[model samples]
Target chain A: MTFEKWMRESLDRVETALEHFLPGTDIAPAKLHDAMRYAALGGGKRVRPLLCHAAGELTGASAHAVETASAALEMIHVYSLVHDDMPAMDDDALRRGKPTVHVQYDEATALLVGDALQSQAFIALTTAGNGLNDAQQAALVRELALASGSIGMAGGQAIDLESVGRKLSRPELETMHRKKTGALLRASVRMGALAGATPDAAALKALDDYSAAVGLAFQVVDDILDVIADSATLGKTAGKDAKDDKPTYVSIIGLDASRELAAQLSRDAHAALEPFGARAQRLAELADLVVNRVH
Target chain B: MTFEKWMRESLDRVETALEHFLPGTDIAPAKLHDAMRYAALGGGKRVRPLLCHAAGELTGASAHAVETASAALEMIHVYSLVHDDMPAMDDDALRRGKPTVHVQYDEATALLVGDALQSQAFIALTTAGNGLNDAQQAALVRELALASGSIGMAGGQAIDLESVGRKLSRPELETMHRKKTGALLRASVRMGALAGATPDAAALKALDDYSAAVGLAFQVVDDILDVIADSATLGKTAGKDAKDDKPTYVSIIGLDASRELAAQLSRDAHAALEPFGARAQRLAELADLVVNRVH
Candidate 1:
């Protein structure tokens, strides 16, 4: 299948798997469930889960195993988006072309929805029962925790808030993105590989290198698109970073250099997957997709 | 040792275990860690950990098996407190005779502190090396997730918020409390048993019964204290529930009957442990303490 086709298929499987785990929407306090579904199942690239599935495929893991990891990663992503859009954070009124949780519901409901989604991510992992052993499950949970906690996304968010309107070095920006964005992306690939129960140290290391490269490349492309695209095409406020006075790679390195850097990182990401031969094609395609996408 | 003395000793062990797991306050973004420490280590009854230890003792589980579960439960309790004190929630300015998290810091910091603490609680469970097999660890994570998630503490909080100033029946009050307060308390005992690998079907059923009875009795006593105690004695805003027009067991059952019900439930809790003989003395004593304490 083509890269886009494979991604669509993988995301479909993930959505189905997640639907099975989510509480039925018919329960009391139906609005909370509605808010959760609105935030989680709404549109996105499904990039994190796609990376997981591709990494797992490269490592010879089964489709089901990769799908479970993908579902878990997506849940974490959804949770972060819900909280990041809250009034205390970015306070954005929209996400993925739709009203954000707080705008669609009240702020209190939005907060609780975020809290529920975060807890539900771990619930999905622990209950995945997709042939992963307990050790694999525990490892996945641990990796995701580190990716989501203060030292990772939360800490990165604090730094981003602190750095608003302030000048930052390239190294400082990279550090912030690495924690805020790269940690979970790296964990996605690692989780997929771990779920296969191969436990190959060298293979895991290579995947980490590949994930780091693509993760940064993904953000660079996002920065480029924020400048080059519009809301109609990007499905959200495109110039939001500039409007918020947040620094971006395109702003720091110049658009031409940023584009060059993205291409270089994509090549590096592809190179890291070469050891897996044809099984790694999806990962290579994903790397290319990360740097080449307009939105 | 008497139950009170045993609880004090067990709580000390739990504190030491928590300190070892938590990052030192000197970590980057020192305020986050400091906030965590300030909220987590502040004085409380340590009732949840005591339940964990008592359950393990009843099941012939060693102290080592229960220590991590104890700490994890306490972390969840601390996280809930942090969030509950947020401006959008109870809007409480104080807790346990000290300024609440938002009052001490800012609303944003308090929100993130709660977020970090919740994430840290699961991190503790995942990384906890208590000799539990992979399945057991997965089960423990799952149990804790359910107890703390929308269907448990978060859900309970939502319902509690909605039910304020509204008359709720005895069963409705019980259901709300079961999820809000009882779920975690019951999970504490169940987790301790699971950590010990002693959660056989019969013992699990017995513990569930014991947990349910004691959980309600605990709430009953809390209600009584709200009416009879002052803020200086309770360390929180006593009578605030009535001040806010929140429903309670005392409101539904009357204070005299509520006390009678608490004593009866405590007896039932103690009786549930008869099968374990003197090994469950700590748990029985805890039931008494729950209903008899001033705070």
Candidate 2:
């Protein structure tokens, strides 16, 4: 299938799976449920889900398994965004061109919403009859938990909080972004691979290398877009990183260098997937998409 | 062994397990890790862990498995306390006789601390070589996730938030508490059972019944203590429910009736374990302790 067609079909499957798994607004605690759906559904480019599904393609993972895993990944990504946008965190109001959970609802509800989404994501992973065996389910849950916890995404956020107004070296900035955003992105690919048959160690390493490059490239492109793209185009408050005085690739290495670095990383991502050849076409396409997307 | 001795030994084991599972404070993002340890390690009654270990005794669950599960349960309980005490939530400043996470750290850090602890809890469950097979691990993860998510503890919290000033009926109050605190408390018992050999359906049902009674009794006693105890005695802001105008068993049914109800629930809890005969001795002791504790 063409990349765009494949992307459209995968995004549709992810949306349906998320809707099926998430509690309805009509349920008890309706407001919290409403906020969860509002935050998760109809938002962002679903990049993580795309990555998960693309990676799943390389292993011939069942579409049902991939869909559920994709939903879980998207939920985790959305939960992070929800928490990040809270008044206590980034204090942003706009996300995906819409009001953030805290702004749309109350702060207390948003907090609960984020917490609930995190739980729901695990629920999606551990839900029975999702086509994954017990070992796969357990491994996937562990992978997600490790990526989401203190040493990973949340730890990165803590570092980000401390790094504000500090002139971080390129290494420090990379470390922060790698943990903050890169960890979950990496987990997305790894989880997709695990959801199917176990690949050879070399193939696993290749996917890891591919994911690492794509993950970093995704962040580099994000930094580039934060500088040059309008808030309208980005669907969030553009230039807030500079305003917040946080370190970024653009700040550390200049815009041109950051762009060059993203290109290099993108090439590296594609190169890492060469072992799988045609089987990794979707992953290669996703690498290009992550590097080249405006938002 | 005497209940007190068993309890003390169990508490020590849980502490050791929690310390082992938690990230070291000296690690990078030291502040977040430090706060996580601070919130989770010292203090609190460790009621959930006690219940888990007590339940584990019934099915001869391995000490290692029960210890890890206890830690996971305590982590979830502590995470709820951290979030519940946040300014955006209950706005409390105290927990376990110390400043709440938000007070000791910042709101953002506290939020992340709670979030990270939750992830860490799942990590404890999914960690390999913890004496559980893959199916057991997956089952346990699902139980934890369901209890923690929107339809469980978080859902209960949302209801509590909405019903702050409103007078809820007894059933309504039960529904809220069941989800809020009851879900995780109940999950603790269920997890301990699952961590070991699978109990027969009848035994599982009995355990469920016992957990339901104990869970409600625990909350009823909490409400009673909030009314009758002081902050110093309770290790938290006592009477805050009344101060916040949130309806509780005491406010709705009167303190005397609430006490009677707790006693009855305690009796019901003990009765539920009658099927297990003397094997449920620890659970029986725990039921009494929960109903009779001062704090």
TM-score of chain A of each: 0.96, 0.99
RMSD of each predicted structure: 1.7, 0.8
lDDT of 2: 0.92
lDDT of 1: 0.83
Best by DockQ: 2
Candidate with maximal lDDT? 2
Instruction: Give me candidate 2's TM-score against the actual structure.
Output: 0.99
Q: List candidate 2 segments past 4 Å from native.
A: none
Share of native interface contacts present in candidate 2: 0.87
Q: What is the Cα-based lDDT of residue A106 in candidate 1?
A: 79
User: In model 1, which runs have C-alpha deviations exceeding 4 angstroms?
Assistant: none
How many pairs of residues in model 1 come into backbone collision?
0
Each model's TM-score? 0.96, 0.99
Model 2: per-residue Cα lDDT over A1-295, one tens digit each? 7888998899899999999989998888899999999999987899888989988887889999998888998998899999999989999999999999999999999999989999999998999898788999999999899999998899999999999999999889889988998889989999999878888899889988998899899999998899999999999999988999888898889999998999999989989998898999899988989988988
lDDT of 2 by residue, B23-85 (tens): 997787899999999999989999999989998999999999999889999999899999999
